[model samples]
Target: MNTRFKQLLQLSAAALLVTSSSQALAWGQIGHRVTGEIAELYLDADTREKIAALFPNQSLAELSTQADSELSNPSEFWQQTWTWHFVTVPEGNEYSLDKHAPKEGDAYTALTSSTETLKDPKATVEEKRIALLFIVHLIGDLHQPLHSGNGTDRGGNDVKVEFFWQPSNLHRVWDSGIIDNQNLSYTELTKWLSQKITPQMASEWRTTDPKTWIKESIIIRDGIYPEEPKLTYDYQYQHIATIKQRLQQAGVRMAAYLNEVL
Candidate 1:
């Protein structure tokens, strides 16, 4: 092959890797970073200082996607953590920690455990580091309605659909399709979202409980499933507000949790 052809092939391979990897994750990088940015804005000075000490030079926005990045590694620990990004609760049934918890540890358990680890005074810096990263990422995951799934479709990953004439799935639509369609970087999206938050909205969203977050996702999930397998502009128009609302709630709640814990 010529040099140009080889370079083209390499680019194609890289694109394919990214596409496949994204299909398996929650909220995608942009969505997670957006959530992180919002949380960073709301974090109190003490919480920010504590987080800086743990991360040294990194900001929470930079660390927001670290859990997903770790998925690229082939370690056993990473394998075990694969399920921590979502939870499945079948339609018509309420989510109960005692009954619905996954054997492999889903997002709910992971978030709660990670928060505890961060709170522990004896936890090593490395342990706190991992826990904090998980908290940041999992909070974003918990907000994606599909992450708290109906249990029949693998969190909509199995429900293939065409979005704007492009092949996609219901889960992918919520995870990145809507956000990507906006064509904004994480910082831009954060600024836009920040401008909309009212004091009442902030007060209403600030909560430390992951279960409440999951329940809110469940309510949103109930209305989101399309009756058909094709989605386009109308679908985006109908659901975009919910997406923005969830992102804002995730950010506020994450900041609340971090502030209380730290």
Candidate 2:
């Protein structure tokens, strides 16, 4: 086969892989957009202007899904970035670069790397734009407790369950089920949750430290497993608040990072 034909075959395989694996992406598209919209609200005026210049017609909400969509791209960057959506901080141990972070990268390292990219004067526009997409995606991903998971169970992907009478995994339930279960559009969800975020809440959540964010997610992950694997209204009732809080916090923190970096 010619080089061009070989490239086409590889691209087709990657696209198939993306289709099979998109369900496992952090926060699905809606949850990530919700965080992006909320982050849009909290951006500094100057930062907003700068971001507009970089993104052209794109809003953060649209950009939020870019990384997940890129899973289909026939590129090494996308291959490496698939791992950057989540991390394993094994139960009972705090995260450390030497102990927990792998050379392959994780949401924590991705955030730090993106921040540095945006902050670097020498970085090209395309480089910073790719980094910005990651910030938009990874910030929300880390907030999904399972993304900062125990090394086992594939971040609860292995812990299968029935969500509202349908087959699902624990990770999917947290990633999109709880929020998607509401049937609200991303804008409505963002508006509803954004109102509850007080000045103090956003201020308190403004830390740029990814370790602190991962720590918070790890604590929440431990308590989230349901005794009954078949989840319904009661399960939603018990955990919906945590989902809302994390979504809101992710948005707040995402904005804070952009405000500080850009």
- Which candidate's lDDT is highest? 2
TM-score of 2: 0.90
TM-score of 1: 0.90
lDDT value, candidate 1, whole model:
0.82
Instruction: Return the TM-score for each candidate structure.
Output: 0.90, 0.90
Model 2 C-alpha lDDT per residue in residues 90-174, reported as the tens digit of each score: 8998889788877767777777777776787866666667777778899888888999989989999999999999999999999
Q: In model 1, which regions exceed 4 Å deviation?
A: 1-24
- Model 1, 61-115: lDDT tens per residue? 7888888876765544554677888888887877788888877778987877777
RMSD in angstroms between candidate 2 and the native structure over all alpha carbons: 5.7
Cα error of candidate 2 at position 138, Å = 0.7
